[model samples]
Target: MSFEFIEVADMSTEADYEPKNIFLTGGAGFIGSHAAILLAKKYPHYNVVVYDKLDYCACIENLNEVMDLPNFKFVKGDICSSDLVTYVFKENKIDTVLHFAAQTHVDNSFGNSFAFTQSNIYGTHVLLECAKNCPTMRRFVHVSTDEVYGEGEDFDAKPMDEEHVLEPTNPYAATKAGAEFLVKSYHRSFKLPVIITRGNNVYGPHQFPEKLIPKFANQILRGLPVTIHGDGSNTRNFLFVEDVARAFDCILHKGEVGKIYNIGGCNELPNIEVAKSLIKILGKEKEMDDYITYVPDRKFNDLRYTITSEKLHKLGWKEEMSWEDGLRKTVEWYKTYTNRYGNIENALVAHPRMTGTSPTNI
Candidate 1:
C-alpha cells in the first residue's frame, strides 16, 4: 500500500508556478464551489476544470456565478474513478490539482464509516495515482481538516502546528489522516509537488445544512428546534469560506511544496454561544429555549481543535470575515434561497446519516 520513495523533482516556486489548467475534485460542494468561483474568475487565463461527483452536499447552483464563464468547465465524475481522473489530467494538460472531494461529516461517519474510508482514503489514492503520472503537474494541494490532529480539548493549550502529531478520534478524522499519509507518500516517493492544508471548521454561504452553523441556522429560520449535542460546550474555530478560498488561492500560488499549512480562524466559540448568535440573528432570542433542543452527544466529541496558521500568514493569507458578519451572511442566504435538497428535512436532523440517497448532478 506504499509508493516507492524517490528523489524530489525540479519544481516551481510562487513566481515560477505557471498554472496552465487547474483541477478541483468536489468542485461543486461548499468550500470547493467557493474556490472554483474564485479561481475561475480571478485567473481567467487558467482553465478551471471542476470534477465533482455532485454529492449530497453539492449543488450546481452553487457555481452559478461562474457557470457562464468561458474558462470554467464542469465534469460530473468521481475522483475514485482512476480512468476519469487520468483522462481529465491528460486532456486538460492539468498542472495543478486541488483535492477537496471527501465524506466530511463527523456525525454521519459514526454510522457510515466505510463511505468515509472509501472517499477520504481510497478516492484520494486514485487521484494521487493519476497525479503522479502527469509530467506537467506542479502542485497537488490536498485539503485536509484540523480534526486529523484529533482533540485539542484544552482551549488554552498551544495551538497545534503543521508538524503536530496526527491523532484522529473519530472514523471521519481517521480516514482524513489516512488520506494525508497517502498524499505525503506521493510527495516523498514520486516528488508530486504536493502541499497539504489542515483547515478549521469553515462556514458561510453554500454550505450544506448538515453542518453546525447551517443546520442551526436552517432550524432557527424555519422555527424548528436547533438541536445541540450534549450541553453544547464543544468549541470550534470557525473560518469563513471566502477566507478559506483566499487561503487556497494563496497556497496554490505561493505555498512551499512538501510543507503543511494550517488555515485557522481567530474566532473560537462554544456550540451554545454559536447557536445563541444564530438565534439572536433570526430575532428569536426571546424564545431561545423553545427554538433549541438538547441531543445526545457522539461517542467521542472533542471540545476544541486548536491550530495555528502563522505558516499560512507568512504566505500573505489572513482571515478577513468576522464571526458576526459571516454567520449573518450564512443565515441570510439559507433563509431565502431554498431548493438544493428539496426536502432538506433530512439534512437538518440532529445527526444526518442518510446513505444511498442520490446526490445532485451538475
Candidate 2:
C-alpha cells in the first residue's frame, strides 16, 4: 500500500490542528498494537504507519482490528537500520515518531545483553538521527520503563517520581536508560523535538506468553502450575495496556518538548496476590494455591518498582480502568487466544526460567 500524508487540521477544522503522519516503531507488539488501534480511532483522517521487525513477541494478529482501516499502513523493518528509518520518514512524510521498539524482557536481557544494547541503545540513536534530518517531524516520543530507577523495595511505601536517579539492576533497564539519555542529548544538542515517558509494569490483552502475567494466565488455563519466583513477594504497580496507550497519546498530543513524564497506575499488588487473583477469576480457587509453585528467583529480581504519574495527570490524562476490571478483561482475552491457537507452548518455544548463565538460556 502507498503511504499517505495527512494534515492534522483536516480531521476537524473546529479543533486545534495537530500535525499528522505518525510513524510508530514496534507497532505490532502488545502495547504498540493497541496504541495503533486507538490512534486510528481517534484520528481517522490521519495516516498511521507501523514499522515493526516482527520479533518473537510481535504478532500481526494484534493488528487484525485495524487491518482494513484505510489510514493504517504496516512496514516490516528494523529500527536500528539508519537508512531504513530515514527512508521511512521521507517516504511516509512522518511528522511524529513513537519509538516502542526494544528487547524488553529482563530475563532475556540478562542472558543476552547484546540484543538489548543493539536494539534499545543503537536503535534509539538511529531513530534520533532520522528525526534530526526529517524537517517535517515535530514530536519524537520515547517510551521507557520505571525499572530505570532500579530496585524500589525500600521505597515500597511511596511512589518513585521522574527525578529519581537511575540505578538499573538489569541489562534491559540499563539499555533503556541509555536510550533515554540519547533522546535527551539529541533534544539538547540538535534541537530535536522529543518527549520521554517512563511507565510502570503494564499488563493486558495480546501480551506474549513469555511475560509474567500472561505466562501465568496461560498456565492456569492449561491446568498447569504457575511458577512463582522466590515466594512471589515482589510488588509492582500495574498499568493497563490501554492506559499506557492513552499516556502515549496524551504525550504525543499535549506533552511539552524536551520534557520527561512518568505514567503509572495507582494499583499496586504483590506478585503472589496477583497470581491468586487470576486463579479466582478463572474459578479454580481450589487449585489456586496448588497452581502457584515457588521457583528460584532471577539473578537480581527487583523487589518493587513504582512510578508517580503526577506529571502526566497534570497534562489532563489519568488512568480510567480499575485494576479489577482490567484484570478480568485480560484473563478473558488470554482464554480466547488460547482457545483459537491451542497450547501456547506448541505455538512458541518456551524460554526456561532464568536459572544459570548458560549461553542458550532465555
Candidate 3:
C-alpha cells in the first residue's frame, strides 16, 4: 500500500480558518527533513519555516529538495538561544511549532550528561517559552523517544504503552523525560497548547551514520566489519523515518492537547538479527557470521525497548513501510552516499564528542 503524506490543506478549516504557518525545529535532520518535504509537497497553501542549529548531526543537503519550494524557508539557528527562538516566532508569525531538535545519542549522553541536559532539556525549555508567549501559536508538538520508558526483556508480548511508567536508563533518555515533564507542566500551568510523541528507533535516508542501522549499512557497504554492542541479544523496535514523520503530522493536526502518543513499529528484532538481515540484503551473507564483531556495550545499555503505538494508530497513524522494504531503501541510500562522498572521515572529525565514552573506558 502507498503511504499518504499529509499536507497543510488537509487540516479542517473549522479548526483554524487561515492557512497555517508552521515553525519546525531541527528541520534539516533525518526525520525532520522528511517531514518538512512532505509538508511542503502536501500543503502548498501553508508556509513552513524551519529553524535548525545545523549541528554535526545535521546537513543542509537534507533540505536540498525542498529548499526552493515556495512555502518552505530555513533559518540557521539554535533552539536553546531564547533571543533567536523568540525572534523566529515574532518575525515568522508562526501559528504552530513542531519541536524536534535534541541530543539523541544514548552512549554519548552517558559521557557528557551536560550536553544532553543543555540541548534536550534547555533547548525544549526555550522553545516552550517562545510558544507560550506567542499568542498566535495554536499548537506545539514535542517529538521524543521511547527510550524514556527504559528497558525490559519480555520478548513474548509486553509492549510499552502511553501510560507506561517512565524509567529512562541513560542520560539521553533521562533528559528527554525531563523535557516531557516541562512540556506537560507548561500545558497545565501556563495553558500552552502542547502535545508529545514518543517513538521507537527511527531509520532512513540522510541519517548521520552514528546510529546502529545506518552505521552498520555504511560500514558493510565499504567492506568493513560491523560492531555489535555486548552479546548482541539486546532487542529494539524500529520505525521508518517517514512513518515517524507522518505520525508527527497526525499529532500536530489531530492529537488531543495535553496527551502523549507512542509511535512505534510492529517489528522487533535482536541486534544480531538486525546485523544478519543487513548482511543478507547487501549480498554478504557469507561474511555475516565472520564479519560480525562484538564491541563492549555502552554504559547502562538497555536490554530491550519495545513500544505499543495503539494510541497513534487510533489517531489515524500507521506504519506503512515494512522492515524489509525500509531496510532495502536505507541500504540503497547509504550505498549512494558511500560512492558519492568517498569517505565521511571529515564528518566524524567534526563530531569529536561522539567518539568519547565506551565500555572499554569506563
Candidate 4:
C-alpha cells in the first residue's frame, strides 16, 4: 500500500529540507507506531528505519502493519547502546532522527525513576552524540510531553505556549525536561538542526492499557472494575494519535529548526469524563456504577495541563478529529485490537508500578 507524498515547501531555512531516510527511535510503541506507519505509507520514497528496544509495554505486533513494506525496516536495539546507535545511523544512512523512544508512564516513574533518567536523558544524549557525527543528518526532532509544564490549576487560564516555563512535578516529567535541555544544548553548541515538540496525552488503538483511557477500556472489556485515581477530576488535553502523527509530519517538512512547537488539542476532558465516555462507547453505560471504582491517586498527580498550538496551526495543521468522533474510534479500535497485547493482566492493573509493571508513558 503506497501513498502520494504531499509536498509542503520547507520554510525553516533558506535551503529546502527534504526527508529521505529516517531513523525513528521507539517506532514500535503507540504514538511512534502511528508515526512510523504514516511516514512509511505516505512517503513511499522515504526509507523508515524503525529501531526499538521492545520494552514491556511496547509490543512488536504494533508494527505488523508496516513490516512487509519494502521501505520499512525494524531493528531491535537499545538507544543507550552507543555502539549500536552509531552503527544503525551509518548503516541506514539516516538523514533525520525522530527520537521517540523513552520510558513514558508516570505511574511507573515513581517506583522506577532511574530507568526513566537512563532512557529519557541518557538515551537522548546517545542519539545526539551519534547524530552530530553523521554528515547527512539534517533534522533531529525530539518528542517531549505537555506534562513537563506541570499543573495548570485553571482550566480557563492562559494556555502554555512554547515559551512557558517547564515545571515538571513528577519524576517522569522531570526526566523529559532534562532531556529537552540536552537537545537544546546540542543545537546551540554543535549546530545540529533540531526541533522539539511537546504534545498532550494521546489516545488511540495501539496504546498499552497502562494509560488511563486504554486502561479503563481494557478493564471494562474484561468485566472488571474501571479504576480511577482520586475522584477522577484530574484533566488532560488529548489528541488523537492520527492527528498527532500528521502534526509530526508537518513539523518534519515545514517546522523551523532550533524551535519548539506545542502540539495542543482542543479536547480537554477530565479523567472521570474520559472513563464515562469509554464506558458509554463500549455499550456499558448502564453498568457505569459497577465498573467505575475509585483508587488512591498518584503521589503527585497534576490537576491539569494546557498548551497553545498557534505555531503549529500556522504550519497548516489543526486537529481534524473531534472529541466525540476520536473517542468512539479509539474505543472501537481497542475492541478489535484487545488481544494485540497477549495477556494484558499486568498493564490492566490500577497501579502498574506497584505491581511490577514496567511502562514509562511516552
Candidate 2 global Cα RMSD: 6.6
Which portions of model 3 show Cα errors greater than 4 Å?
A: 1-19, 339-362
Quote each prediction's TM-score. 0.95, 0.90, 0.90, 0.94
Clashing pairs in 1: none
Residue ranges of candidate 1 with Cα displaced over 4 Å: 1-9, 12-16, 356-362
Query: How high is the lDDT of residue 104 in model 3?
Result: 82
Q: Could you tell which candidate, 3 or 4, scores higher by TM-score?
A: 4
Candidate RMSDs in Å, in order, are 2.7, 6.6, 6.3, 5.4
What tens digits encode model 4's per-residue C-alpha lDDT throughout 267-318?
8888999999988888888888998899998998999998999999998999
Cα-based lDDT for every prediction: 0.86, 0.80, 0.78, 0.86
Worst 10 residues of 4 by lDDT: 1-10
- Residue-level lDDT of model 1, residues 1-362, one tens digit each, is 32333434465434546577999888888999999999999989989999988777888889999999999999999877899888989999999999888888888789988888888888989999998898888789999999999898676799998878889999989988999999988887777888889999999888888889988988887879899999999999999999999999999888777888999989999999999999999999899889878999988999899999999998899899999998888888888775665678898888788664222211
Residue 301 lDDT in candidate 3: 78
Worst 10 residues of 2 by lDDT: 353-362
* Backbone N/Cα/C clashes per model: 0, 0, 1, 5
TM-score of 2: 0.90
The candidates, ranked best first by lDDT, are: 4, 1, 2, 3
Instruction: Tell me model 3's lDDT, rounded to 2 decimals.
Output: 0.78
Superposition-based RMSD of candidate 1 using all C-alpha atoms, in angstroms: 2.7
What digit string (tens of lDDT, one per residue) describes model 2 on residues 133-245? 99898778899988998987675357778777888999999999999888877876777877788988889997877777888888888888788878789988888999988
